[model samples]
Target: MATLIVEVDDNKLKMVKDVLKAMGVSVDKKSIKPEKAPNETTALAIKDARNGKVTKVESIDVLFKSI
Candidate 1:
């Protein structure tokens, strides 16, 4: 047997884990935890999201303008 390492987005982690479980693959969740603490920007973004400070884009022009 060979070991494989995958880097997946946090939002997609559950999907990946579910697929692996269906295949009878063993997943070491502890190893998947972040090795270091989140950076300031990441921490701020998470805080903002939890506070419902998100903006909704209704069109492409508005999206590009925000960027």
Candidate 2:
């Protein structure tokens, strides 16, 4: 069993998750919040796509064994 950590555009997070799920992989979505609020902070989300068909991802950060 292996874990993959991916940093993707906030808008594409949902699309990524759906792709992973279709491949029978379990995914977890995490939101990155700034420690302090700023005038305008860009929001980012993290998605953990694990198991099955991970080799199909080509454009996202792929971390093996990263929880």
Candidate 3:
């Protein structure tokens, strides 16, 4: 098992989660909560992605299993 922290647009969270689930990955929403808590950071980020606010995303963290 491992943890993947993706800094994706707010609206894309659902899609990302679904994709991860489909890929057989265990995702923990509460663990990888966004940085701008309680705000529309994720939503705004998604909007920005749609409106070309940013060419690419800021950053993402992924924890891999040591094996």
Candidate 4:
């Protein structure tokens, strides 16, 4: 059997699932999560950046000043 991944809005999720079920398609309740990077350090850094847990460097002078 082939696998299908779909991303739907919260409001349309139920409707999409219902349609698929009516077509005899099995729907898994669990949502698919993004795969992490092979390097744990890189994955953590990416997560931190996404969450705004990063320092903003205005200019080279400011960056050097912090060093």
Candidate 5:
């Protein structure tokens, strides 16, 4: 037995599940709700973003490099 988590696009999600089902796979379904309010640091970050305190990135390379 194996378990995995996958993130899929909303538009393609049903097609993906249907294909897996047709292939004789069990798609044990569950939807986990997001936790409330986030953590303290995450809350602060969200607050900052809402307040327009973020820096604008000029290049995609710079964004990826920073991460």
Candidate 6:
């Protein structure tokens, strides 16, 4: 037995599945898991960025100074 893996964008998932089905491939829904939600730290970072809490540095010197 052989295994093939494909990563498809969310918007194109249905189309890709339909194409695979037409080609006689068995699309295993059970094996496909939904994407995981961001962890607490990542979620907070994203929220902060969305709320304009990001820092912009124009040079290495400035970046190192900020860090």
lDDT of each: 0.56, 0.54, 0.53, 0.57, 0.55, 0.55
Superposed model 1: Cα runs more than 4 Å off: 30-67
Model 5 C-alpha RMSD to native: 12.8
lDDT order of candidates, top first: 4, 1, 5, 6, 2, 3
Writing each residue's lDDT as its tens digit, candidate 2 over 18-55 gives: 87788788987654557854232122212223335333
Which has the better TM-score: candidate 2, or candidate 3?
A: 2
What CA RMSD would you report for each candidate?
A: 14.5, 9.9, 11.5, 17.7, 12.8, 16.9
TM-score of each: 0.43, 0.50, 0.41, 0.45, 0.42, 0.41
Q: Give candidate 3's total backbone clashes.
A: 1
* Candidate 1 lDDT for residue 25: 76
Candidate 5 stretches with Cα past 4 Å from truth are 36-67
Residues 1-67 of candidate 1: C-alpha lDDT, one tens digit per residue: 4343344556767876776777787864423237877666556655665675744345434433554
Give me the overall lDDT of model 5.
0.55
**Candidate 4 segments exceeding 4 Å error:** 32-67
- On residues 1-67, what C-alpha lDDT tens digit does candidate 4 reach at each position? 5444344656767876787788787976544346733366545545665676755455434533554
The best candidate by lDDT is 4
Q: What shift in Å separates residue 42 of candidate 4 from its native position after superposition? A: 20
Tens-digit lDDT track for model 6 on 1-67? 3233344556767876786678787874323334877666556655765676754345433433553
The numbered model that scores best in TM-score is 2
Locate the minimum summed-lDDT window of 10 residues in model 6. 55-64
Query: Worst ten-residue run, lDDT, model 3?
Result: 58-67
Clashes of 6: 0
Off by over 4 Å in 2: 36-67
